[model samples]
Target: MESTMQLLNKALSVQRAAAWVEDMNLSKSAISMAQKRGRLSPVLAGNLAIKLGENPEHWIAVAALEAEPESELLTRLRKAANSWRKL
Candidate 1:
């Protein structure tokens, strides 16, 4: 099962996770389960990326901004964006 950290890493957008759940297709309770349960939802995070039509690696980069809205996430995101472009 994918850990919460893994989901956070992949989605790059914690907001997307919240949104995905709010979309009525999923639920926060489900997310909580995925997070709290004994790794049954390992694929849930990856599934979220697929459902969002996003690349898994980039998903966390996209969501990282939301993950840390008040601090260095933005600066780090900028640097990561520059780095990503170079690659």
Candidate 2:
């Protein structure tokens, strides 16, 4: 699964990402933190996915999975997210 930083890098430059965060009324530091941590909060992920014309649910699931430690549930949810992405 692609990290939020990966998705952002694919769709926008660092400057553009920061500008987008600002446009969303969020601090530019949000983008910086996601880049540094290689993750995003589910809400931010959903919003970013929408801005990039991707499925928000898929990203929301992915972000949720990433926020937690590995486990059977995470694996199952990852599979479900991948399946949802195919739709």
Candidate 3:
């Protein structure tokens, strides 16, 4: 079984994570939607105590604390993208 913490909010940037979820090929609109409506933030945040699942601010704070370093996160994203290509 996978730990919830490891699986949840794996990407600090919701836009990046959304891109990953959206087949790892980034869409500009996906980024814009996350900024405008925070459509992806809570899905990334996962298992929060907040009433509304779409709390972008809380998502940002948690992501900052839980996220891997920038280089590491980018590497992970890169690996995901490549894996998608193989599929």
All-Cα superposition RMSD per candidate? 10.2, 2.4, 13.4
A best-first ranking of the candidates according to their lDDT comes to 2, 1, 3
Candidate 2 lDDT over 15-70, as tens digits, reads: 47757866789885887788788888899888878887888887887788789998
What is the C-alpha local distance difference test score of each model? 0.52, 0.77, 0.43
The clash count for each model shown is: 9, 0, 0
Deviation of model 3 at 60, angstroms: 0.7
Instruction: Report the C-alpha lDDT of model 1 over 1-87, residue by residue, as the tens digit.
Output: 123456544443546557756763775676666555423243454466676564555544444433444567677666667666334
Instruction: Write down the TM-score for model 1.
Output: 0.37
Give the 10-residue window scoring lowest on summed lDDT in candidate 3.
1-10
Candidate 1 to native Cα RMSD, angstroms: 10.2
lDDT of 3 by residue, 1-87 (tens): 022243333443333445454644445564455445433443444423132244445454444433445587667765665543333
TM-score of 2: 0.75
Off by over 4 Å in 1: 1-4, 12-17, 38-43, 52-87
Number of the candidate with higher lDDT, 1 or 3: 1
Clashing pairs in 3: none
